[model samples]
Target chain A: MNERSLSTTTRATVPIHRRATLWDRLLEPVLGVNACFIYVFLYMPIVVLIAFSFSASPFSAVWGGFSIDWYIQLFQDSEIARALRNTLIVASFSMLFATIIGTMTALALSKFQFRGRNAFETTLNLPIVIPDIVQGISLLMFLVLVVHLALGLPTIIIAHTVFNISYVAVIVRARLHGFDRRLEEAAMDLGATEWQTFWKITFPLIWPGILSGALLAFTLSLDEFVVTFFVTGPGATTLPIQVYSMVKRGVTPEINALATLMLVASILLVTLSILLQRRRSS
Target chain B: MEKQRERGQLALLLLPSTLWLGLFFLAPLGIILVISLVQRGGPVAWQLDGSAYVRLLDPLHLKIFLRSLTLAVLTTFVCLLVGYPLAYYIAQRPPRLRHLLHFFVLLPLWANSLVLTYAWMVLLRPEGFFDSLLHALGFAEPISLLYTPTAVVIGLVYWYLPFMVYPLYGSIEKFDFTLIEAAHDLGATRFQAFRKVLLPLTMPGVMAGSLLVFISALGTFVVPALLGGDKTLMWGNLIQQRFLSTPQDWPLGAALSLAMMLFMSVGIWFYFRVNRESA
Candidate 1:
C-alpha cells in the first residue's frame, strides 16, 4: 500500500523512473499522441454532423455557405413536430412512473430487511442485461400475439418504464449506501410517524438521487428506438423513430438539423446527470 | 406487533416495483418463451413444435450467426487494443486532470448513440463526407465503404469504444504503478515489466471490458441496420426483419431472441465469476 501513496505519474517522470532510457523517454509522448488520436476519432463524426447542419447544402459534405435553412425546414415539418411531441410524452410519463416505483424499491431494499435478496437483484438486472432488441421483440409478442393489444404510445411507455425502473433503482440504491439509517430512526423516535419521518428526513436526503434517476430515465426514453420501433403501431412516431425513417429514406439536411438538436439535448442532460452523481459521491 | 408492522411496510414499499416488473417485464419474457415453442401456421397454437429452433440449424441461418459472432468478437478485440493506451494515459493523470479526462471518456456513453451512428453514416456513405474530403485533397472518388461489413465493424467500434475504456480505467486506476518500479529494481526491462507484472495485474479489467463490449456488440441493432445495409445481417437485424417485415415470422424471431438471451446470460455469468475469483 506504500506504492499507493504515489497517486500520479509525476513521480515516475521526475524522480522515480529517472534511470529511463531513450525508449522510456519516448513512451510518454507516444501515449500522449495516442490519447489525442483516440479523442479525435471519437469526436470527429459528431463535429462534421453539427458543421453540415448549418450548411446550405442538402447532403453535400462541401461547405455551401453556412445557413440555418435546415433548421427552418425542421421546424416547418409537421411530422417532425408531432414526433417531438410524442417523444416528450413518452419520456415524461415513463420517467414519472419509473421514479416512484424505483425509489420505493430502493428504500425497501436498503432500509428494510428482506429475503430472496439475490433473486430480487437478478430480476432487476434482467431488464437491464438483456439486449434491447430481444426485450423489444418479447414485448411485441406479448402485446400483439398473446394479448391482441394494440401497439402505440402506451406500449412504448410501458416498455420504457420497465427498463427505467431498474436504472432508477440502481442509482438510488447507491445514494442510499452513503446515507445514515439512524436519521430516520431518530425522527421516528421523537414521536414522528413513519410517514412523517420519511417526509422530513429520508425524502430530502435522497431527493438528489431521485432527481438524477428521473433525468436518466427521461434521457434514455427519449432516444429509445429498437423497442419503440418493434412495439409501435402506426401514428406514434417518436423523434428517434422519425430520424430512423428519414435517414433510411435518403439524404435530407432536415435530419442533420434534427440530429444536432437531439445531440445537444442529450449532452446537456447527461452532463447534468454525471455532475449530480459526482456531487453525491463527493 | 411492531415487527409485523415493519414487515407490512416493507411489503408495501416493494409492491409497486414487483407488480410492474411482473406484469410488464417477466410476463413478456414468458410470452416470448411461449411463442418460441408453438407452431406458426396452425390455428391450434398450443401444440409444441420444434420447427423454429430447428430452422436455426439451417446452414444459412448458422452462417449469419457465425458471422455476427465473429464481427462482435473482432469489435471487442479491436476496442481493447485501441482503448488501452488511452485508458492507461488517463489513469496516470493527477486528480483534477483525471476527472476531466474521465468526463471526456464517459461523454460518448451518456450521449445519443443513434446520432453517433448516424454521424458515421454521413462520413462512410458514397459521395459523402470522406469522398468529398478525398476529392478536395485531389484523390480518387468513392471509398465505397458503405453497405459493407467493414463499415459495420467501424460503426460498432465507434459506439462501444467508451464501454471498453470505462472498465479498463476502473481496474487500471486501482493498480499499483510501483509494481513496475519494483520489477525494474529486480532488473526487468520496461517491456518485460509490462509483460510480467502490469498485464497480469490488469487481466481482470481486460476481461471485464471485453465482456461488456462483446455482449453489447453482439446485440446491437442500430449500427448494423444503418451501416450494415442488406449485406451484413446480424442476429439483431435478422430478428428485427422477421418480426417487422413481410411474412411476419414471430416464432423464428422469438426463438432467435431467446438464443441471444442465452448467449448474453452466459457472458454475464462468466463475467461475474471472473470478478469473484479476482476479488
Candidate 2:
C-alpha cells in the first residue's frame, strides 16, 4: 500500500515537472519572436527608405522600377549642394567652438571645487531640457531685439554652440568622472608648468573624451533643425531646413535619396564614436 | 606660485563656456521671461503688462498644454513597457553579445530624427509600404496608419525608446544576479523573484529613463508635425505656428514659450529632487 502511494505521488509530480519544462519551451520562442518583431519594427522603415531611394517613381508609394536617377539629380541640384555646403560650414564652426568651450568647462568643473558648483552644473545642463522650439524662438526674438545679431550663419552658430556645449560637457564630464588625479599631481611634482602639464598630460589623457564630444557636437550641429529654422536668414539654409521645406511641399524621391545619405553619414560617425569609446574602456 | 597659476589656468579654461552661456542661453531666456509679462499691443508694446500671463491662462492654450502632457505621459509609459524587457534580455546576454545589442539600440539615435520622421511618413502613408505589406499578407483593407495620433505615439516612442533603454540597460547590467538566485532558492517562484528582487533594484534606472523620455517627448515638434497630420495637434506645433505663420503674434508666442519653459523647469526640478533623494 505504501509503495502504491509512492508511485501515485511520483506520477503526479512528473507531470508538473513536464508542464514546467513545456512552459519554458513555449516562452523561449515567444521571447525570441518579441525581440525580432521589435527590431524589425525599428529598422523596417529605414530599410524601406533606402529601398525606395533607388525606386524610379517620382513619388515614394508607387515603385515603378529601380533607378538611381534621384541620386544623380541630387548631385546635379545646386541648391541641395549649397545647403549641404552651408550645413557643413555651420557644423564645422559649431563643433570647433563647442569642443573648445566644452572641454575647458569640463576640465574646470572636474578639477576645481567651489561654491555654486551644483548650480553651475545644473544651469549648463538646462539647455538640454528646454524645448528646441522655445529656445529657437527666444533666441530669434533676442537676436532681433536685444543683441541685434544678424540672423545668419553667426546666429545659427551661436545657437548651435549653446546646445552643443551642454552635450560636450556631459560626455566629457562622464570621462572626467573617474579620471586619476594622481597622474596630474605626478606631472606637477616633476616640475611641469600648469599649461605644459595640461598639454602633455591632461589633454592627452582626456583626448578621447574631447574627440567623442566633438564628434557628438558635430553630429548634433549637422542634424539640428528647429533652432536653425528660426535663426537662419534667407541666405543660410542648412540641409535639415531644406529637408523640412521639401517635406512640407510634399514627399519626393530626391528627398529619399538625400535622407538615405544623411542617415548613412550619421550612422558612420556614431559607429566610429562607439567603437572608439569601447576601445578606450577596454 | 604654482597654485595661483593653476587657479588662473582654470579661470582661463572656464571663461569661454561661461561667457557663451551667459550671453546666449541665460540672457535670451531672461528676455523671454520679460517679454512674457508684456501686453500684446500697446504704445509701449514691449513694456511689462502682466496680461500675457492672463493670456496664458486661456482655455485653448491650457488644452494644448494638457494634450502635450498626456502625450508625454503615454509615450513614457509605453517606452517603459517596451524598453524594460529588451533591456533585461540584453543584460542577460554575454558581454560580447551585449555590446552588439547595445549598438543596435544606439543605431536609431544616431540617425537624424527628421529622417526618421520622413521614414515613418513613408511607411504610414495611405498606400505606403506598410499598407501594401499588410494587404499582401491577406488583409482585405489597407490600414489607415498615417496622420493619426497613433502615428504620433509610434514616432515619439520610437525616437525616445533608446533613451529609455540605455539607462535601464545601465542599471540592469549592474544588477546583482546573486540576489535573484537567492530569492529563487528560498522557494520563491520565478515571477516572485523578479518582482521582489529585480524590479526594485532597477527602479532607479527606470525612473531616470522615463523622466528623460517624458521631458523630451513633451517638447517634441517634428515627430508630431510630420506624423500627427491634421488630426493631432501638440503644443510644439502650436507654438511654431504662432511664431512663424500668418498670425505672427509675438506676444502670444512669447507667452506660450515662457509657459512651456516654466512647465519644464518645474518638471526638471521634481526630477532632480527625486534623483537626489534616490541617490
Candidate 3:
C-alpha cells in the first residue's frame, strides 16, 4: 500500500511538470479566448432580453428610451392575468396529483419484487423519452374521440401529469433506492401500524425527495408549452403559450419582463429544492 | 400475516400510478397508432384506412423525417464534443469549485427553454444585439444570424448541453482516477493513459448523454419554431400546424407523429441494446 501510494503520488505530479510546455503556453490564450466566447454566447442573449424589457420601443430590435410602461400595461391586461391564473391552477393540481402518484409508484417499486417489475419501470419512463408533440397530439385525439373528454384544464392537467409523473417518479425512486428498508421493518417490529410507520418514519425520511419532486413537477407544468398548447381550449392559455404567441406575432418588451420574472422564480425555486435535497442526503 | 399485508399494501400503492398511466399514457399512444393508419374524409370520418401511411411515404414527409434525424444526430455529436471536455474539466477541478461549475451548467435548465429561445432571437436577429455590437466594432453590414439553420443548431446545442454534461459529470465523478495514474506509472504517456484508461472508463456516461440529447433533439419543436422561424420546417412544427390549425388534417398529422415516434423508438431500442451488450 505504501509503494502503491508513492507511485501514484509521483505519477500525479507529472501533469504539473508538463503544464509549462510550449504547446501548453500556446494553447493557454486560445483556451481563454474560447472560454470567453462560450460565456458571451451563452449570456449575451439573456442580457439583451433583460435590457430590452425596459425599452420603450414596441418593437424589440429598435431601442427607444427606457420605460416601465409595458410592465404597467402587462398588469392591466386581463387576458394575461387570466392566462396566469389558469397556469397556476393547472400547475398546482398537476403538481399535487403527480407528487402523490409518483411517490406511491416510487415506494411500491422500491419496496416490492413482483414479476414484470422492470417492464413497469420502463413504461413509467417512456413518456419522458417520447416526443412532447407526439404525446400531445395523441392525447388530444384520445380525449376528443375515445374518452370524449372536453378540451380544457382537465386535459392540460392530465397531459402535464403524464410528463410530471415520470419526473417525480424518477427522483423519488432514486431517493428510495438508497433508502434503508430496515428502518420500516424496525418500525413495524416496534408495533407501529403500516400507516403509522409510513407517516412517522418513511414519509419523514423521504419528505425532501417528495418536496423536490413536487417543485420539479410544478416548474415543468408552469413552463409547459407544446402539450399544453395542443390540449388547452380557447380560454385555457397558459403563460408559456401566451408568451409563444406574443413572440410569433412579434417581439415586445412585456415578454422580456415576463420571461425575466419567470427565470428568476424558477431558478430560485429549483435552487432551494436542490439545497433541500443536499441537506437531506448529508 | 404481516408480510402478506405489506405485500397487499405495496400492490395498492402501485395501483394508482399503474391505472393512471394505463388510462392516460398507454391508451393515448395506442390511439395515436390507430389514428396513424386511418384516412380522413370517409363517411365514418375517423375510420381506419392506409392513406395516412401512404402519405408518410411521400417525398416531402420523408425529407422532413430525414431532416429531423440529421438535426438530432448532429446535435448529439456537437453536444458530446462540447460537453465531454467541460465535464472532464469540472470533474478535474477541486471539490470546492466543482459545485460552482455544475451550478453554472444547470442554470440554463432551470430557466424556461422558450424564454431561452426568445433571448437567442433577441441577440441573433439582424438588427439586434449582435448587429449592434458588430457595427460598433466597425463592421459595415449587420450579420444575418437569425432564422437560419445555424441558429437552429446553436439553439439545440445550447439548450441540450447541460443534459449531456450532467450525466457525463456523474460518470466522471465515479471514475477512479487511480486507474489513470496506474497506467502512467506503467510507463504510459499522458495521452496514452487518457486514451486507454480514462476514455474507456467514461464511455457509458458519454453514451448515455449522447443518447439522451439525440433522442430529445429529434422531437424538439420550440427551438426550431422560435429560432429557425418559417424558413425551417422541422417535423414538430409541421405536426403542430397540421393538427391544430384550420386544415385539421388529423390523418397527416397523426401519420407524421407516428413516423417520428417509430423513428425514435427504433433509435432508443438500438441504444438500449448497444448499452446492454456493452455493459
Best by TM-score: 1
Residues B69-186 of candidate 3 have per-residue lDDT tens digits of: 8888899998887777777666655666677877888788878889989888878887677777777678888798799888989999999988898899999877777776567557
What is candidate 1's TM-score against the reference? 0.96
Q: True contacts preserved, each candidate?
A: 0.68, 0.53, 0.53
lDDT of 2 by residue, A22-135 (tens): 644565576566667778878988988998998876444546798999999999999999999999999999999999999889989999986788998888998887889988
TM-score per prediction, in order, is 0.96, 0.91, 0.91
Candidate 2: residue pairs that collide? none
Provide i-RMS per model in Å. Answer: 2.3, 8.5, 4.1
Give a tens-digit lDDT track for model 1, residues B161-212.
Answer: 9999998988888888878877887888888988998888888889989998
The model with the greater DockQ, 1 or 2, is 1
lDDT digits (tens) for residues B1-279 of candidate 2: 977876787779888988999889888888777777776653127666777667767898888788889999999999898788888777766566777887798799889999999999888887777777777677778788788888999999989999999999999887767675566557666677778888988988998898889988988899989999856889888888877786566677778887777776787788779878867
- lDDT per residue as tens, model 1, A238-277: 9999999998898678888999999999999988886787
Assess each model's interface with DockQ, reporting 2 decimals per model: 0.65, 0.43, 0.50
Q: What is the C-alpha lDDT of each candidate?
A: 0.87, 0.83, 0.82
Q: Name the DockQ score for candidate 3.
A: 0.50
Candidate achieving higher DockQ, 2 or 3? 3
Q: List the candidate 2 regions with Cα displacement exceeding 4 Å.
A: A1-25, A58-64, B1-3, B42-44, B135-140, B272-279
User: Top model by lDDT, which number?
Assistant: 1
